[model samples]
Target: MYECYLTFRSITPCQQAQRYLTGQSLRSQLLRTPKSIAFKGCGYSLKLNDTAIGLAAAKLRQANISYGSAYRIYSDGRVEELYL
Candidate 1:
């Protein structure tokens, strides 16, 4: 399975995004933004399946929720930055 990580400006937006995604029928998990990718310290993020990435982004856009960045994580542990 493919995975995607979406970063938010702060924990609040991250949590909000999680709830929004859940209500939209997408599964997500809350996790800390990886230190290497996080420009700021200790920010929260949402971990989601790749298949839901597009729909999730669209919903977040429609809801006017902003995100910092996104990344696609590979099975072998490599990560590629994603433009939503």
Candidate 2:
């Protein structure tokens, strides 16, 4: 299973994005941004499958929801930005 982290500037947008994705039938969960990449003390993000990444990002973009960035998470705990 492929996983990716969708980061946001703040919690509200992060939550909004999560709800929005769910409405679009994409499975997502609110999660703390990995400590190594977190921007603030309580940074939050949306974790979703890679298969849904493109559509989720597109929906957020269409809704004008802002996101910080996206990262593909590896099983070994490594991460790399998803260049959308």
Candidate 3:
């Protein structure tokens, strides 16, 4: 299955997003942002299944949590940047 990495500007928002997503019953993993995809500088990210991207995005929006860019990691190792 593909995975989606949702990047955040800072660790604060990243942690808030993880907590909010957990409250909404969505599964996410908090991890250091991959060097290749980290925004601006070092950061963190929420890793979840690609299937949950839409609902997760909606939930985050409803909670007023802002995030940076998102990237979809393909099974074959290709990474595509998402504009959402």
Best by lDDT: 3
For model 3, residues 1-84, the per-residue Cα lDDT tens digits are 577999998889999999999998999999998876764898999998877877888889888899888898777777889866
Q: Write the per-residue lDDT of candidate 1 for residues 1-84, one digit (tens) a residue.
A: 457888887889999999988988989989888765677777988988887887888899999988888888777777788887
CA lDDT of 17 in candidate 3?
98
Quote each prediction's TM-score.
Answer: 0.85, 0.86, 0.86
Q: Per-residue lDDT for 68 in model 1? A: 82
Compose the digit string of candidate 2's lDDT tens values, residues 4-29: 88898788999989888888898898
The true-versus-predicted C-alpha distance at residue 47 of model 2, in Å, is 0.3
Which pairs clash inside model 3? none
Report lDDT per candidate.
0.84, 0.83, 0.86
Q: Lowest lDDT 10-mer window, candidate 1?
A: 33-42
Question: What is the model-wide C-alpha lDDT for candidate 3?
Answer: 0.86
Better of 1 and 2 by lDDT: 1
Runs with alpha carbons beyond 4 Å of true place in candidate 1? 75-77
What lDDT score is found at residue 79 in candidate 3?
Answer: 80
